[model samples]
Target: MHPATATPTHCPYCALQCGMNLAPGRGESPLAVEERADFPVNRGALCGKGRTAPALLSSRVRLTEPLIRSHATGRLEPATWEEALDTVAEGLDRNRRAHGADAVAVFGGGGLTNEKAYALGKFARVALGTSQIDYNGRFCMSSAAAAHQRAFGLDRGLPFPLADVPRTGCVILVGSNLAETMPPALRYLTELKENGGTLIVVDPRRTRTAEQADLHLAPRPGTDLALALGLLHLVVAEGRTDEEFIAGRTTGWPAARAAAMAHWPEHVERVTGIPVPKLREAVRMFCAPESAMVLTARGPEQQSKGTDTVGAWINLCLATGRAGRPLSGYGCLTGQGNGQGGREHGQKADQLPGYRKLTDPAARAHVAEVWGVDPDTLPGPGRSAYELLDALGTDTGPRALLLMGSNPVVSAPRAGHVEERLRALDFLAVADVVLSETAAMADVVLPVTQWAEETGTTTNLEGRVLLRRRALTPPPGVRSDLDVLHGLAARLGPGQGHPDLEKKFPTDPAEVFAELGRASAGGPADYAGIDYGRIAREDGVFWPCPTPGHPGTPRLFLDRFATEDGRARFVPVEHRAAGEEADAAYPLLLTTGRVVAQYQSGAQTRRVDELNAAAPGPFVEVHPRLAESLGAVEGQPLAVVSRRGRAVAPARITDTIRADTVFMPFHWPGEGRANTLTNPALDPVSRMPEFKVCAVRVETVDAAGRDTTPSTGAETADAAA
Candidate 1:
């Protein structure tokens, strides 16, 4: 039978933004994924996670009411929306009155819509007047964004569209496993190969994505910088360098060339463990093509020197005349749903709307004018994501935190410590669709609407802004995130001395978008010309659209770069050791990533039976040789210990990974949370933590029922439960 009328929209998972149709239909079949063949990004393709996303809307797993912790019983119980909002306002007010404005902190996420991110930032700066605000996107692509801005003077996840991927001559997939992370995107690589374009995958393990590459270089974890430098050296040595392009369109080539020349094939072979012959072959494969592109993801961007690491890769593109041309450039494979737009608006700590720097007086004045406040009243930039999380509840930190749409308990580096900081907070309020591990610890939990039940805009990895039209009505007692913010603003605004703050926080998504456009005008990520009508009509509008009649930009830097002189700048860099390295105490390197069946933090996906059955729990992937050396058998529990903490998970021995390295997926909580063993070493430029690599040790768990770690989603009882 043909389903009832449907709403054509995009998926709510990754940055690919795969288009799909949601059929609200009728009772017992309220949600369905139908065919949507028109959208260009994914061409109606959906992955397993997208196919199973409707399962998350079931009342059987999602929260349907507001919850407040009772003082007498000390347990979270159902409460009216008014009561929950009032309590949250009082908690935030009390904390602010006692300590200071900065005592009240706000934490946001990459999954939020453009309107919500903008409103959240305005709420922090205008309503509560606090500087302590940041989002999870900092962990996702800050390094790439930093590198992009430094080189091109602008930062978009991908400078060009995905449509160009199939036509490019060669693509160097750096540290991104698109085959497993976003299966629908892997088709781009497949199409590139079909077009006679060579594909090279660089990673520490032979992942499913690497299996499809013409050449796979499995370097030691944290040695991506050396690997990239070595390829550039070979390009120069082979006389493959585009001297004319470097001299005309780029600057700082001499210093960058000197840096690459210092790292010869033999020296890079010792650092990255890729052999001298493989380096020469990689250079030949990359330079032989008329046009090539370099793309990086979390693998190289989550290290201590992540910004410079990405910079090194961009140098290769500039040296070979690949950047700022047709079908060739440098891009970042953004991982989160709205990671590209999350920081582009105002959610990040150091940024204002339109990707403006908070430290810039002109930027502060522009955003402040839109906010209807004195520019001097605006607070300065605050701590980054990891730094903000580490400072909670301390004498030098905020006492109360309002966290929305993020679950740092499961996703943050050093999980146990972040949880401890959460517990130390005097007042904690969370707004989410489910009682996530982090939300379960909050004093008040506000149930919010999901993607299918909300109308908003999200900028995808291609810088295309797509509109997600609401298909189904939200369950009773639950409201959209905008409504939650509006209600809180009404109660907190007057007390914070703004009598009309509630008017600034609109419950309607379109109205919020209009205001966001004004705030984002004349900035890097200009959205002045784009509105709800334009976005809905155009399918998706690329950003920097300054006027209503102007067509959005699909490709950047084609004619000229976004710099002072329209020339890309190259910063000289050298390879350095990771924040930590495997020593005698920790003989193995541990790297963490995501699974195909689960999304970030596993908050909503873990509630789905199908996804859970597909990926029941987290486990450690060990090399066959390393497993045998540790006296571990397949499925045997093994305890992985680091300087911060210990986590135990069943072992799955495989030769896909390096013998000296092990792998874990960080989508779980408690004992199996790979983040528990991660280090919080911050990159000097990007402030991104070293989550991709850390030193660790493995030990066989005693089978005699001794102390053992609990599996994912099997945490101890909480007061709310």
Candidate 2:
């Protein structure tokens, strides 16, 4: 490839996957980004993280060579790729010899391209013959996915494209702070308002996105399910539901409606702390419109009751006949860059290449034949991401682990404990572009190629499969993730011990994608017809694109749901308190989220000078009244302690949040690590950790480390009253 050519690509950040052109830099310089105006998703818009993405590619921050931890010195030292690969292979084989194949686990990331995700899953099953494989995406939107699958019979983040937002009559956005998390996508909501459509934002705090809403319902932390049920109750009581539509297109609505009726407005107000009048107004605004949509994000999905909470919201949509209709449906704002694709293409614990259930004999047979393996050889389903990590270093857990693209040390809930688990692993190998917090603890760290240095395909939030072309060659010693997988598979396969395993893994992305298409031929997330050529010819193609001549399905469930009966199922759900509730010892609720300037875990973005300057460090956002009671002032250090651990950050007093709640951004590690205090209570169905709400108490600290009582401000009297 020539240095001056511009390669069309997508941002390596959020699910929005804002399109951009990577212009090759002159003579050894890194690639520079240019506006990709033709791409419909973002048009020409790019966020701060997207604009400065190339900064992480600088030689100063990027790892150019493999690092091996020396036992004698207890320090990581540079080594040739050959030596590092050999060490990793030897360690993994030794662990497999002692423990079973399940004792060697693999952890994938949501940021990987679809090919890489597909290859990683195949590598775990065919190469290592291990069932213990999962990814960080389990923590992102599994709850929403489970809810979507239960309600709609399929799990595509958004049933319709972002362009429909402006045309919709009303949209109830639950728990997403698009203004900060996804700035480019915020324009869609802005356009909706400009188009005279109503926007209702539901969150515990009055976020930047909520400020622009026609109605902002600030519920208590972890009370979103109750709030949703309350709205549905109002809808049913006021006869706002589409009885005809529900009767025609949905099933099990009678039970769902009965459940909603149980949660009256007054009872919901007591549970969620939102007045009954506001609930009524919200229902009126949503139902008065001809069509409306309900969208959820991490806030409602990252709870112990996440699946049911999201189900409640979906039930609201079903009762109101908002789904499976033009311009109205249920959607999830996927968080990670490739969170949508990562789950669909086999990296998930229980999924096959095409989002097929691993337990299904037919699905297993299809993918097995595609991989040139026997169906029976494939291992059964395994634990989810958090459960896999939790089992590490334990007697029944995997003895060795191979991780790529994820930094769970700073990102996982109860992260302090996860860090301990990582430290206890007998052999840990990590492949990443930078030395992340988790990578630094690994025995062998393999340098891998990044976004512009590799060519692959990714399915965005809209289920649109887009191609990311290679713009430049990677620096010496850095290889693509596929190369690493290929080497490992070659070393671990037939030549080493198992004679049957031979040349099963492919290093080329296109070749792997071709195999993926075959594996996904008739699965739910069917991509049998999508190829790199089709992606390049057209801007992108939506999935369930089964044949070459068939146009892709842009909107799902328009004619009928994916269920066997061709009808949407409404799962009855009721409100429940959060996993951890406020008590005397910990009399406040704590929540965590992202800041505009930093990406997840802050592994790459923290290395960027501009991003670091913008969001220097983490802080606790406390309500002004809470700050007054805690004797904590703005800029003063506060120690937020939970049952799990404690994290100290400077207090940032704001009235935007509720008086009994505190918010923290989980991008930093050590003293500012919000995950340190987060609860790891898992949702029964989704296995999602309760990162949204945990019980914690905030106390002021003096410069000398002594605790001090909060001094009451004169202005706090009225606010507290």
Question: Best candidate, TM-score-wise?
Answer: 2
Candidate lDDT scores, in order, read 0.90, 0.91
lDDT of 2 by residue, 327-407 (tens): 999999999999999999998999998899999999999899888888998999999999999999999999899999999
> Clash number for every model?
0, 4
The alpha-carbon root-mean-square deviation between model 1 and the true structure, to one decimal in Å, is 4.9
Residue 452 lDDT in candidate 1: 89
- Model 2 residue 326 distance off true place after TM-score fit, in angstroms: 0.4
Q: Estimate each model's TM-score.
A: 0.97, 0.98
Model 1's TM-score against the true structure: 0.97
Whole-structure CA lDDT of model 1: 0.90
Q: What is the C-alpha lDDT profile of model 1 across 1-721, one tens digit per residue?
A: 2235888888989998889999864454478887788988888788888987888787888899999989999999999999999999999999999999999999999999999999999989888889999999999999999999999999999999999998999999999999888898899999999999999999999999999999999999999999999999889888999999998999999999999999999999988889898888888888898999999999999999999999999999999999999999999999999999999988899999999999999999999988889998888899899999999999989999999999999999998999999999999999999999999999999999988889999999999999998888888888988898888889988886777789988999999898889988999999999998998888999998988998999999999999999999998999999999876677678899998999999998898888999998999998776665566789988888899998988999998988778899999997899999999999998999999999887877787524443321111101001
Q: lDDT value for candidate 2? A: 0.91
> Model 1: which ten-residue window has the lowest total lDDT?
712-721
